[model samples]
Target chain A: MDTAQVFGALNIIGLFVFAVSGALTALRNDMDIFGVAMIAFVTGVGGGTIRDVLLGSFPVWWIAAPSAVFICLAGAVAATLAQPLIASRLKTLIWADAMGLSVFAVLGAQAALAAEAPAVIAIFMGAVTATFGGVVRDVLLNEPPLILKQDIYATAALIGAGVYVGLMALGLGISPSAVVAALVTFAIRAVAIIFNIPSPKFARPRKTEL
Target chain B: MDTAQVFGALNIIGLFVFAVSGALTALRNDMDIFGVAMIAFVTGVGGGTIRDVLLGSFPVWWIAAPSAVFICLAGAVAATLAQPLIASRLKTLIWADAMGLSVFAVLGAQAALAAEAPAVIAIFMGAVTATFGGVVRDVLLNEPPLILKQDIYATAALIGAGVYVGLMALGLGISPSAVVAALVTFAIRAVAIIFNIPSPKFARPRKTEL
Candidate 1:
């Protein structure tokens, strides 16, 4: 497979996990079925959609394919239907979300490169496409976005993108470059979670000189 | 002014409006003082920040100057201090918002042109920059965005950008072209509000046969 195809596969896999994570979040928040579906849809496509739309991508990347929508639906439905059984065992969802965040970050940077965007732009796109979906999800749930919280979500994605840039600068092949980036992101998120890296709780402003 | 200076002026003016509008939104939503400031900051810069960051225009446009941050702070402070007086004139907020929207749309497009972007991208950028801030505000408020609401807000902005493009195609000078576009946008938005023009709303999905 070409490098693009490899990244495409990773993107699809990431979409699935993001969608599932969104659905499970909705269910936990006690939203209705439509809300669950909406959250899933938004989270799955949110990052890439923002990237493409701003890049002036015609027809939008996801609109060109039924596969994206279909997978999101399947994941949402599965999460919604299986919430009762799976809520008891939360480890799977957490792991899936972490993996998806990594994969999405890698694929996002690759897509930016493929679009012939500048390196700085590619790295920013990677982080935005990786983390903004979860931000939307959390904001919609009335929680502080994961980024604003103490979680290393956006930070992990950014560091991964930096690695990707470094590898490319070294004249490494795209295949190895992408894989290395994804692995770096995955490791950051996993290690952070395992070590109980906690997000800062949303707080009111304290007394200060203004 | 030089071409770049003109673009610079439009950007700062647009940011001013956006910041003020965001503060007003927070006030209307009954947010805390800090919450209001945060909302104002985000709403004022959110859309353009998204546009520039994704486009790799770092350290994003506002980071170049302390002015954008100052404006946001100023707006928030004014709004907070003027809450009683502002509250008494809640009826005027819509007009203020509409005016801000129109100015921002034209400014966004003009900036894109100055940057030598394609006509289509410039047009989209106008709408994106004007609308996305409100979208973030509404989403945070758990309301469907104004864009998806029954109004001609986006349509007005879109037409204004087209007008700007048309003027340029007709070999009009940049100053005249910009003036015409801004006038057109303001007129469209004003007419919509005065005449109560409404866009169609999204309906719930209809049931289908299995």
Candidate 2:
């Protein structure tokens, strides 16, 4: 298979994991079937949708390829069926989610670079692609988004995307650069998960007029 | 001078109103100055950005016209300065927000029609353009989105966009249709606000296995 196809496969895997994470959230909230499906679809495709829209790519990725939609649906259904096991194994789910985040961040940067976006924009797109799905899901669930929570998630995406672009500019081939970037991202996230990295939050003002 | 410019001016007014609404929300939450600015910016432009991206319109509107950005910033600053008066005059703010909703809904439909989208997509884009900005602001503030709360807000945008598209399809001129549609939307939203309309919510599932 071509390099693009290989990356596409990786992304689909990431999409499935994200969908599962969304479904699990819905289940935790005791949402109805429609809510479960809606959350699944949004979490799986939300970041990519945002990325495509920002890039001005037409029809969005899932609308262009319905199989992606089906995959997300299937993932949600599977999570529903395996809820007991999933709830008990939250740690495993986080690891899988980290892997998905790594793949998505690299792919997002690659898509932006292909579109001839500036490096800074490409990196921002990468972080958006890796994180915005969860943000949307969290907002819908009335939880503070994971991006804003004390976590090292979004920063890892930025670093990975930056590394990939930098490697490409240094004359690395596409395949090698992408693989290395994804691995580096996964490593950073994995370390954060293991050591429990805390996000730096902006402090609230001490005084209120009211 | 032209039809588009006239509509563009109307949209800027709408943007200003949305920014003010966002700033008010930030003040109500006792957020800091940075939070107030961020909320104002998102509330003014988030909906239109989503619409443009979905329509495959590149560069985003504000990127193309820095004046819109300036308008939102100015509105936010003004709202911050006028917070005490704003907090006291909640009723007036609701009226202003309804006016913005009307104008944005019509403008969104007009933009979609100009892009040669199908009527259904055009109407959907209009509602999205009017409502999603508020959704983004609420999400950022960790509140239940007003769209999800008991209100006729989204319904007003849908009705307005539908009226505009239907009028245009019947060979009415753009200016007349947009103006009439905006008035219709404003009237519906005004009625809802005065009457305290409630939304029909989906019932939550009965039991959770976990």
Candidate 3:
């Protein structure tokens, strides 16, 4: 398959996984079926929507291609039905989410390039596209945003996007570049997950006595 | 002043108020200055950005008009410095917020119309413009979205947007239509704030014994 085909297939998979994660979060929060679907749609598509908006891509990707919407809805329903099994395998879920993030980061950069965005903006778009959906989900669930909580998540996305953009600039084939980028992201995130690597935290200021 | 001039002046005030609200929320959450500025910018411009993106307007309004950005940043700084006084004057804050909502709804609809969006789409855009900023603010602050909660806030926006659209369809001049619509929104929200009106909520479903 060509780069476009490969990216298309991986993007669909990423969307499904992200949707499932969103549904799972919604279910954990005791949301009803509609809420589950809403969260799933938001989590699966929110990042891309933000990226597209910033790039001035109108109608948004999902609206132009309803297949993504269908996939997300299906994934949410499947997740709702299999919540017990999925929730029990926390490690498996995290791995799947990492894979989704990796794929999304590469795809986001490609989309930005297509939009003729600058390299920095493209990288930023990639990171936002990869992770902002989860941020939206966490926000709706009234949880601290995982990105801001220092899981090394956004950093992973930034590195992945940077790698992809840099390789493309060097005249590397898109497919190979994307593959390398995705692998780098997934590997870094997996290592972080396994090692429980804590991101650096700021020291809290001491309270002064009046 | 013409309708455009009036809208321009009110829009700046709306942006400032919205930015102040966002900055105050960030301050309460103990975020740093950057976070305060980020939140303020998002809350001030997020709604219009969403609307413009959906309509396929390029570069976004804030990017095209740096004045908005400057206003929001200044508002955030001012809010940060005046936190104590602003926080103490809760009633005044609410009144300002109501005014912002009123102006945003009308302006949002006008923007949609300028983009040649269909009437229904314009109305929806208006509501999104009026309320999505607060949604962004609440989400960032890890609070349940106020629009989805009580107080009839979204309802007020919808009514105002609808009234404006309906008036325009009836061949009412833009300025008069906007004035009537803004008044309607402000009146409804003000009454709700004064009377402590509670939006109807659905009763929780009984848990079935498995």
Candidate 4:
């Protein structure tokens, strides 16, 4: 497949996986079925929607493409049906989330580049796209955002986006660059998960006086 | 002043109060100075930004209007400086938040109507605009969202938006309709707060079998 076609396919996978992750979270929180679908839909599209708005892409990608909405609903249903068989929902969620994060990071940067944003903004958009969906889901569920508290999550997306942008700038082919970047991001996340690393923090003490 | 000019003035007040509320939350969470500013800025413009994006208004409102950014930062600074003097931060925040929510609910509905959205969508947008900023703030701080948990918050916005739309449909003038709607919203919220009313809940038992 050509670069655009391959990226399009990966994007679908990312959306589906993100939806499942969101649905799982909603189920864990005891939300109703409609709430599950709504959370899944937002988690599937939240990051890219934010990026598109910032980049001045009007109507967003999903408004014109109703299939994306169906895909999210389907993911939510699948997650709900499979809940009983899943041996470890938390582990499944983490791995599925890692995949979604990696794919969206590259695609988000690519989109920003297409929109002619500066390199730095494109990189920022990449991380935004990769993380904001989960952020929205967590926010709605009243949970601490994994992006803020987890080890090497947004950082992995940033590095992945940087890798894609840097490679493209050096005249690398889009498909290979995208593949390499996504894999690198997943690897970083996997390592973090396996080793149970904590996200880095500044040394400044919390101000109790405020 | 004309309706548009009056609404513009109220919009600035809404933004400022929302920023102060966000800054106070960040301060309570013990976030650093920059974190305070970031949360304040997002809480100031996030709802309108989302509205503009969904309505296909390119670049969102704040990108073209840099003054909003400065206003939010000023609010953050003002809140930080005034922290010691404010005898009851929680009370101040609730009142400030009520003002922001009232103004934005009317404005959001008006914007959606201007964008030619259906009446139902416009009302939904009103609630989204009035509540989403606080939702974002609470999410970042890992707190339960006030909109979902507080009494009559989103309900007040929805009713206010409906009133605005209904009045305009009945040939009421913009300024009077807007003022009436905002006042009604604030009154509902005030009553709920004063009486310590709880949000309505469905009688459905929690689904533990998921």
**Pairs that collide, model 1:** A150-A200
> Please, what is the TM-score per model?
0.58, 0.61, 0.61, 0.61
lDDT of 3 by residue, A1-210 (tens): 898898998789889998988887788788998999999989999889888778777778898798888899998988877867654745655766788899999999999888777786677678878988888888778768755543567778878999999999999999999999999999988988889886432322222310
- Across residues A1-210, which tens digit of lDDT does each residue of candidate 1 receive? 788787778888888888998888887788998898889888888888766655556567877787898888888998877777764525766776787788878777777777776776677677767877777877777754544433566668878887897798799989889888899999988887789674322232221311
Deviation from native of the Cα of residue A207 in model 3, angstroms: 16
Look at candidate 3 and tell me the lDDT of residue B12. 93
- Model 1 chain B, poorest ten-residue lDDT window? B84-93
Please report the candidate that would top DockQ against the real structure.
Answer: 4
Q: Which stretches of candidate 2 lie over 4 Å from their true place?
A: A1-13, A23-42, A49-88, A116-124, A135-210, B1-46, B49-102, B113-125, B136-142, B148-210
Per-candidate total of colliding backbone pairs = 1, 0, 0, 0
* lDDT of each residue in B40-132, candidate 4, tens digit only: 999999889878878898778999899999999998999999999999888888888899999999999999889777786677678778878
Ten-residue segment with the worst summed lDDT in candidate 4 chain B? B201-210
lDDT of each: 0.72, 0.80, 0.80, 0.86
Candidate 2 TM-score over all chains jointly: 0.61
Please give the lDDT score for candidate 2. Answer: 0.80
| Residue-by-residue lDDT tens digits, candidate 2, A1-210 | 668877888788888988988887788788999899989989889988888877777778788788888888998998888876654645755775787789888889988888787776677677778877877888788766555442567778878988989999999988888889999999988887888865433332222433
